[model samples]
Target: MTFNAVTFTVFLVLIAVVTVMGFVASRWRRAKQADRLDEWALGGRTFGPFVTWFLLGGDLYSAYTLIAVPAAIFSMGAFGFYAVPNAIVLYALGFLFLPKLVSLAHKKGYVTLTDFVNDRFGSKALSLAITITGLLATLPYLALQLVGLEVVFGALGIGGSGSWFVRDLPLLIAFGVLAAYTYSAGLRAPALIAFVKDGLTYLVVIAAVIWVPIKLGGFGEIFRKGGAALAGKTTSTLDPAIAVNPSVYLTLALGSGMAFFLYPHAITGVFASRGAKTVRRNMSVLPIYTVLLGFVALLGMMALAMGVKPHDGNPQYAVPQLLSAVFPPWLTGVAYAAIAMSALVPAAIMAIAAGNLVSRNLYRQYRTKPVSAKSETLVSKVVSVLVKVGALVFVLTLDAKFALNFQLLGGIWILQTLPTVLFGLFTKRFADRRALLAGLLVSVVYGTWAAYQVKSATGGPFGGSTAKPFFLDSPIYIAISALALNFAVVVLGSVLARALGAHPRAAGVAEEPVAASN
Candidate 1:
């Protein structure tokens, strides 16, 4: 693919503007004690409705929505619509549980999900387990953001066919800019940039939705052409005649919905809000983004209508290629910039959330001496930069499909913690740390084996996250099965530990009542 100077210039300008906004966000709601972990990592726990809405929207919708979701639809047809209900179920689950989580975190001054688990279970080891699981889970998610940016870069013809170093140079530069702003501004960086990321996304997507269909004749013609183009492709069984396997779709929705809040980045966003009501209100409004996602997914079929196959067989570039071919060079630039910024915002937040897990849960727990809150914040900022660098390495060295597959694997691993974190919130019976550990171990081992057995549509083993366990005809999401195994282990382990005379430990700190408003 040849580079487009006009598109590249427009992309650079938008990136420059967003970069400036990221730095300025440090002062958006400047805390007197800005070095405090809560202030640095959670925007002083003071984000109100509007800010919270955008921040959570940015955090959840993600670069994956912009790139991978479309790629999935483009490659797999109707199967990719799984993202739609997955998101809907996520918000529904959030409405039921996020308020309680926000209140609990606020009451306990928790900085990460691990903090809540640590305090609730009164076990540092359990906290460490959650922290490790979070970091591992988040790495691939962060890498997915880089993959999204790479697709945008490829669209602009910046790095599609070059030497390895040349191909990755733009990604490195983008990661550097992201790390610098996030290190300085912390959670506020993404919070501020979410506005631009989402605004440009809405504008570009709405424009494409209207323009692309008309250019392709109409929706009727677009689908007809798309179906014809996808004809005889085994993976392209997209229409009703093909009939999606219900088991795969249902489990994918339920499992992904349950794992949504378990993500450290998602929890970090929830923790940033000012009050329980802020979380609940945001949950109600976040589905607007999901509606946009449904439209975004359609861009795949539109790409098929325009006969836009991605360069180098990378389906992730399908939407970008479609936009570039269909829109003018300048509008295509704006669209690519939106896609790039979508990657940047979430990558920044995920690094911060993972950094918090390391600094607060791992470092603070294992350190020989007491650490100051200021130092903890400082360490986290530094770690955030390193986390981004690590993800950058993953992006450069591995296949982009690995990042997507690992993200699904990540969902499996993160869900294993639910027996401890989510269930522990409601019941004291399963508070035994050993039982939680047993459940986590069982789930991880089983999920990994299941993932390993699945072959990728593109190639290789462990290429996908769905499996047909016990030789069932319909495939089920590995995470759902893993979660079931995790729950069983927790139940049985708890009973055995009780028989062995294990006792629940009390949370050392006092829980205060949280205010109901911002």
Candidate 2:
């Protein structure tokens, strides 16, 4: 499937134009303020309802959704539908908690979720813990976006050889643009370009649904062929390890639902909104994509009907393979561009979110006078570049299969921060510092052990399972479970210390006002 030079030219031109538009959106400020962290990092916290919708949606449904979800469906059957419901569960979770978070962020001028945790827990150590957890968890997430773009570029055959430099040139170019605009414009750049990303994605997915059936025989016949290909099973529903019974379904769904909004990158999107109304309105309307997600998942069945095979070394290419077969050379190039740009937008946002954690928490952890707004933003920008470059190395040099597993492991590790964060949002009773550290350690150890046990047969990729008796395969998402352990230890340690009459000084009381920083 060779894309003509004209199609390639149009695709590059489209990306160039959107890149300029993204940089231009940095000027969407409400005031003339130039030095505040809010203005530079959170888009001045002034994104209206529509802008907020696109930004949050783009940030959430990223390259992972564009490529990974459909690919999952293509390879594994109904197990891929987990993405659709995961999205639904996310919105439902967001609806319940985001309004209160928006109100608190507005009143308190909170830029990152760590700000809220630090304030609520009165423990700088715990805040720092959550901050590091977020930044670490986002590494593979950012890499997943790069992997998505790599899939698109490979489909276009942009780089002819499988050589390290050649295969990754498209990733390098996409990352360069992403880093530049994200550095120059901050969150507003991605928030603005999300409009284009979402629009093109919608167009591409809709065309796939409407055109694919006609291109083949019809929906029923397509499934019939798919079923025959898969031994009379059109779509194998549910994962046996994780989705066995009603209890497994409920636990996986509810646990992920709780953890989804708890991620710091997820909070970055929430804070990007101008106000509570913007957040609320977007929450109500974002579920419209459930229909599109359903369509994308069904593409797996289409791939099965068409007997699509995974691309060389990247299982994520199944969706692009199906599309390239269906569309003309010109439109195929357009879809490839959409997928490439899809990864770029989220990779930029994740890099920025992770950088905010380091610049705000780790860099100034020991500073007394406190870091200035300009210094803080500068640290964030520098770290953002370094993180992307690091992820790029992983994409180009390392095995993506292992990298995907590591990302799943990160989910487990990050989930450990949930208790100190989400419950801390409305209460301060459980702010026991020692207990928090203990819980993080316990969950990290257990999750890592479980992930490591997943060794595959024939000395290939590990494929044992994420479940451990009572747990499921998504063990990285057990942050809430880890939080329970953390709280128990904190309570016991706090009690023993009280009996011995030992106590650490209360922290964060002498910090400057939140509004002052902004």
Candidate 3:
């Protein structure tokens, strides 16, 4: 795994170019009074169909999608490929609700999901809970991106076999560049860089899907060998199996699809769009990346066919190592660059979203006096830098395997907000603020306890994310089960409150007046 100078050189050049572009992006749209939170955090809601497409696509098909999805396939076989259907259903779900969200956000000047929750229920407490949950969920997700970057560095032979700092020096440097540009350009940085990330990703993936199969004889031969290898394994857990557990598969796909747009980063991307038309167009078009993901997932099968094993216990390295092993140093460099940029673009957006969550929801709530728009944007920029740094620290200290579990756990936490944010959008009955809080607390507690009971290969409770509750036949995704519980609590609690004649304090101010657009 010695570093190839050719590959390393190419990687550095691409990194340098992208870093410069990220900084330059601050001026790309050139919004007047860029100091406002809307301008800085949402790109002034000016992005049209083309830029919105790339931005949201880039946000969704992250390094986690490129690296971790393949890694999951490599390690977990048919179950890991659940990401394919999950992505398709995710867009289908998005098509139904995201445009409405975009319209509401534009009409109300809402920059974060918490703002919507606050306005809908007129409860600062509910808004604060939503804000805290978003920040907590987003941090680990941001760390997962850093883990993706770390995998790239490890694949390049820039790390490992060294002191801790030496191994992590490259990551720190990469994150420093990310933080700087993100602070300067905000959402625009990732929005512009998404073009380059998506282009490189498509080129590398298309080449691998085509070239790797021919090199290995054919798709038929590759699968035959892959199946043989899996069949020889003694353990059911680690061994590759073509059959997916129907219960697990369906829950994961449906639960994750529902939670996709609920993510702050996804909402941030949507809010940046120019209109509902832009949101709808992007939703229709984003599935092309899912097709690309299908091809990328095959890289895991290719690795299996070649009998390539990851150096570490982490399966996340499977795709990166496969690319380095199969492609020339130069093309591998380009591929690594693509994967690295995939990490950067999403990390930047997640940080920005986290920052916005804090500034708009937390910071403003606590302030004694009104915070000017300029002041809010400044605080968000500072907080954005801090968020990236925190993620860098998190990835540096935690096990890479835990990073994946953390992301899954994050899905559980974020999904709890759906009862309030998603359902509250269309109905006032579900707008009971206290019920929202009660549902959120119960779901999180149950999900965390369930996750804690599921032991990991790493030999720790809470180390794995999926668990079955109430002794289901097949394991259910904890998030889905938790969400069901949340909905029940919301409904039952809303009923009891009304039965007692306890009017929600928020009910008086719940509905935002909608003006007719000419």
Candidate 4:
């Protein structure tokens, strides 16, 4: 794709607008103690429903999701919708269970998910387990966002020449802009820019849903052509008509939904909310993004109907190419900018959330010396920078396809923490800290191996998220399969710990009272 001056100009203008917005975010909801961890890391835990609606929307439904979902649908067919059903269970869990955690967080002044784990179970080891898992899972997911931004760069013809440094110079500048605003404004930067990212996304997707199908000769023609093009060679259910191997669909959706909120950014958004009402409000409306996602996913089929060819056979380019082909240079710029901003908002939030986990849970939790709030915030801020640099390495060194699996790989690792972080929120039944630790350890090992066993046609081991289980006839998501194993271990361990008179060791931290818990 050759460069278009109009598209590039419009895209840069929009990006400049948001870059300024990000720097200004520090004052949007300015707190009394701006340098403190809670204020800088969490937006002072004062977000209301409106800001949070876009914030969570921007955080969870990111450039990686927007680009990858459509790319999957474009290349593989209806199987790509597997990532969509996650929203149903995600919001249901959010509406029912998340508010409970929110209330607890409000009472306890918890900034990180590990903060709650440490307080509830009285175990710093359990907290560190969650912290390590959060960091490991988040770094790759963050790198995947750059993959999305790089797509926009390709569409604009901005790079792909000169030395490695020259080819990626645009991305480096983007990183610089993102790092600047994020370091300046912290969580507020993303919270503010989310409005722009999400608004432009909705605008572009709304246009594509209506316009792209029309160009493709309507939904009927799209399905007719798409149906014929998408037939599978085996029982993989590549066609829209066949939903065979429904177990794969069900389990992936369930696992993804279960793991969605376990992400550090998700929990950070929740804690930033001023109250449970804000969370419930955000949850009720968050599915708006999913609805948009369904439409975005349809672009793949639309591309098929129009016989849109991918550049270099990379399906990830499907949406960008389609947008550039169908829309004028001006709207193409808007669409490209939307996708690029999508990466920045979530990346900023993820870095801040990971930084919170490190400074609060990992480093601060075990420090022999006292650390001031400002110093702790400083530590987190620095960690946030280093975290993105590490993510850059993942992007520069590895195949983006493998990097794509990093989120799934992260999920396999992150899901291991569910039994420790989320389960304890409900009942003390799974509250045995030693049992929880063992569950986390065992699940990480098993999940990694399970995912490693998956060999893709193109991507090697860790090639895909779904694979045939040893006992199951159909392939299942490693996160779900491994989570079952995680739950079993913890339940059995909890029972044995009970019978053996072992208990959760108290960490001697005083608790603040809120709503009652079991």
Number of the predicted model whose TM-score against the real structure is largest = 3
Model 3: CA > 4 A from native: 234-243, 456-458, 504-509, 512-518
Pairs in steric clash, model 3:
none
* Cand. 3 TM to true fold: 0.95
Candidate 4 per-residue lDDT, tens place, 1-518, comes to: 79999999999999999999999998987988897898998898888999889889888888888888888887777878877788888998788778878888887789988888877777767777888899888988899998888888987898878899999999999998888888889999999999989889999999998997777778999988877776632324232233446877888788888888989989998889888888887788888778888998998888777777777778888889989989999999999999999899999999998889889987788899998998899989998988888888788888887676667789888878877755666664545777788889888988887777665432465766676667787777788878888888888887787787663443122243256232
RMSD versus native structure for model 2: 4.0
Each candidate structure's TM-score, on Cα atoms with residue i matched to residue i, is 0.94, 0.88, 0.95, 0.94
CA error at residue 473 for candidate 1, angstroms: 5.4
Give the alpha carbon lDDT tens digit for every residue of 194-226 in model 1.
999999999999999999988889999988988
How many clashing residue pairs, candidate 4? 0
lDDT of each: 0.84, 0.72, 0.84, 0.82
lDDT of 3 by residue, 1-518 (tens): 56899999999999899999999999998887888998989898999999998998889988888987777667666677888899998899888877887788898899999888877787877788888888888888999888888888888888776798888899989988999999999999999999999899999999998888888999999898877765664444431222356777888888888888888999999999998888888889889888998998888888778887787656777888888888999999999999999999989999999999888888887899999998899999999999888888778887766766777788999989988866666775545678879999999999988887775542664665566678576677889889989999988888777787776564423775342231
Judge candidate 4 at residue 328 and give its lDDT: 94
Ordering by TM-score: 3, 4, 1, 2
Residue 198 in candidate 3, Cα distance off native in Å: 0.2
